[model samples]
Target: MKSKGKVYLVGAGPGDPGLITVKGRECIETADVVIYDYLASPALLKYAAPTAELIYVGKKGGDHTLPQDGINALIVEKAGGGRIVTRLKGGDPFIFGRGGEEAEVLAAAGIPFEIVPGVTSAIAAPAYAGIPLTHRDFTSTLAFITGHEDPTKADTGIHWASLAKGIGTLVFFMGVKNLPHITRNLMDNGMAPDTPVGLVRWGTTTRQESVFGTLENIVERVRAAGLKAPSIIVVGKVVTLRDTLKWFENRPLLGKRIVVTRAREQASDLVKRLTDMGADCLECPTIRVAPPEDWRPLDAAIENLAAYDWIVFTSVNGVKFFFRRLFETGHDVRALHRLQTACIGPVTAETLMGFGLKTDILPENYRAESVVDAFRGQSVAGRRILLPRAKEARPVLPVELTRMGATVDEVTTYQTVQVRDNAEMLVGELADGAIDMITFTSSSTVQNFKALLPEGEPLERLLNGVTVASIGPITSDTARELGFTVDVTAESYTIPGLCDAILAHYQRL
Candidate 1:
């Protein structure tokens, strides 16, 4: 007989992926199988190993799903087969999540299990809406009550009339459908008809929405607002704090739709940071970098490295592709012996440094002009300069080097080709005004954005109400020439600075 494996009953927290506890994330990463409920955010599943099997046991209102018996049996069967099973639920599993029943079954089946506590929705949902459950002036006591009960229960144990006066604040989970009945019950039981109430839907996620009103009008207001299920209802003086405590919606890029035009592989960090700052990010890769069409030029450049006095790299891709060719040609960083190297920016400089070649000149400010200034007043009449760069880069460096009387050899180190197909989903989203902002990291991105989009709907008009943010002046200038107003520009050309710029803009507004 196979040894039974231990089971982990984990709470996934509210809908926000980040709200998941450290313990919950650990179990999810190691579990052989994950059984998740509907309320748990689907994003959490990405943390599990690719080999782990994911089983969905979520039940929506009035929807038939895996019965409790079957779910419990599946857990036991998997554990008995020596599999580590994770029962993932939204919020604290033991609190109104029917985790008690599941635990009972596991215990009866002799399957050892551990319960990992979660940030219960009862607290998280209200807190996300900026409502504190307890306050000295409002009320010291708070109560959590389920608006629904088991159909076959011997009695509806809760006394509505007594509860109306027993607690200072009342939080109702799974109560949106029965809002009318609940409101009437509270009022009929002597609670004030005008007590403040707030409904938080999709709490803790980017889609979170809050609707506030009095007990007498909240039902009608929520209906008018089209509030859906998976919402929490809070009724008490604490609900009044939302106006002052609300901060999430006020983030710098909170409602802006931004477009990211970097390669998909390199865009995740920037996209995630922008999204976390409350901007809706649209990923559309305008330029895809690939190995050089032929490495002869780069190979020759590496062979004659010492013949050049200066080697300039304009982008990180140039450094990467140039070195890749060097290695392929049986050369190494030693090939760069006795040559002064200049990088246009920190990113390029860091890439070169990674290959054990420290940059001799990195501009304090990252720009072509700053690079030119770095070598100002230096004699170059007899010096040989080598430039390994992208095929379509600007002529500024070569033109300036020629004017400086230096013998410059500019060779293409890599190729940047356009993506043949436009992302239909991104286009559809743009057409429907679903986007909030568009971020351009380069002039190429701005130009490509226009190229991918339909002609008549100029990028400016397509982004009429949306904000256009750029990483620096060059990208901002490209956006301006294309007739789109630049909304935010980072003080520094980096992702963190871009996020800070976006946040500062919103904070000032």
Candidate 2:
């Protein structure tokens, strides 16, 4: 006699992964089992607990993974077993999502359930494309209708007459396939042929594209543009406003597919910045950061922090891993009060500042030569300096410091290993000339990316027409040594600098 668990039919919102409501995200985090749809952004899955079981019940038009009855039965079975289930739908569940049918099934089975509404594509897609559904100047009334209907029904369920004449604005979801039928039906019902229309594909994302035409030629235009399903179709005089109001399509980096070569854990900021600028960023993390095989040297350095006059950090990972080891050994930030801290760049300095520590030295440029120059006027006749950094980092900093009469004890805090999760996919994309650019943030990312490629694959052939963007000169030199034509270099050697260079290159084109 086990008690039943509750089910929540939650809406995942429109295409933008960020559009999901906070409550919807919380439901996913707490759910014991999550069943998501094809339209739901895969990025939302990161919110679910790692222990939760995720099942895909995606049902695209004419391609049902699980029939409606089967989906209903699956939910009943999971809830009966006392597992909380989150049924993630694309848009507002009650609107054309068949949420009512599933809820009725759960009700008949005596399962406790709740419905969570989402921002439907009907309104969101058009809005992201810069079209207002209702306007004081255009039309005041709006209607939402399905572009496809059931074949089993003997008659069409939609009222074509009222929609044509009465509705001032019309939005059809999943309507690309039935464009001809939809246009003919509207015109037959006395809708004017000259009425404007707009089709938005993959709206609200970096890959979003919009196509515009009048009702008389919209179908042909959609075909010419090769717009696919999961598109939003807007009809009526409101579509005319898209030309004056289109903002997303006019972005500088729109439609450009760029690859990010930072480590997976560190790629978020770079990815977000590029996506915000309308680049379709592919997160291809080249290396993964991890603890060194042995912690003895790092522990020894921490135990003797009082003997050192300077502690230098070369990367954000160095600061992160060094502090992690410090806290793990029962020491806090106070242990470093006797030592002055120096960082190579602003990003590393910011990470150190996050731990309530101030930097004594921050070089203007992000390089070992710059750090060496920054310490030229200081007296280091007999100062002991401790550097905790990547295992395979360059030795120029320590070598130069020792010449300046300083005793430098460099210890390895972390190591980076190459990752090959999608090497084959990357190769395919490159071979097909689908990739437009590849960005390198560090020398390690550049090295590991070359290592991940198939041995002896000609770099020139792979990057024939692709632009190579580097964060700084050090990274750019490494890319050049590998025979890559460096097209853009960030003057500031920062994430935002790299993004600006990429945009500037495109703007010039």
What digit string (tens of lDDT, one per residue) describes model 2 on residues 1-509?
Answer: 99999999999998788899988999999999999999998889999999999999898867999998989999999999999999999988999999999999999999999999999989988888989999999899999999876534779988999999999999998889988988988999999999999999888878898889988999999999998987999998988888778887777888899999899899999999888888888888889999999999999999999899999999999999999999999999999988888999999999999999989999999889999999997888699999999999998999999999999999999999888998888888999999999999988889888887778889889888999999999899998897788999999899999998998899899
The global Cα lDDT (0 to 1) of model 1 is 0.85
Tens digits of lDDT, candidate 1, 142-170:
88889775534667767888778888999
Candidate 2, residue 57: Cα displacement in angstroms equals: 1.9
Model 2 lowest lDDT segment of ten: 147-156
C-alpha lDDT (0 to 100) for residue 12 of candidate 1: 96
lDDT of each: 0.85, 0.91
Model 2, which residues run further than 4 Å from truth?
Answer: 150-154
- Local error of candidate 1 at 289, Å? 6.0
- Candidate 2 residue pairs that clash: none
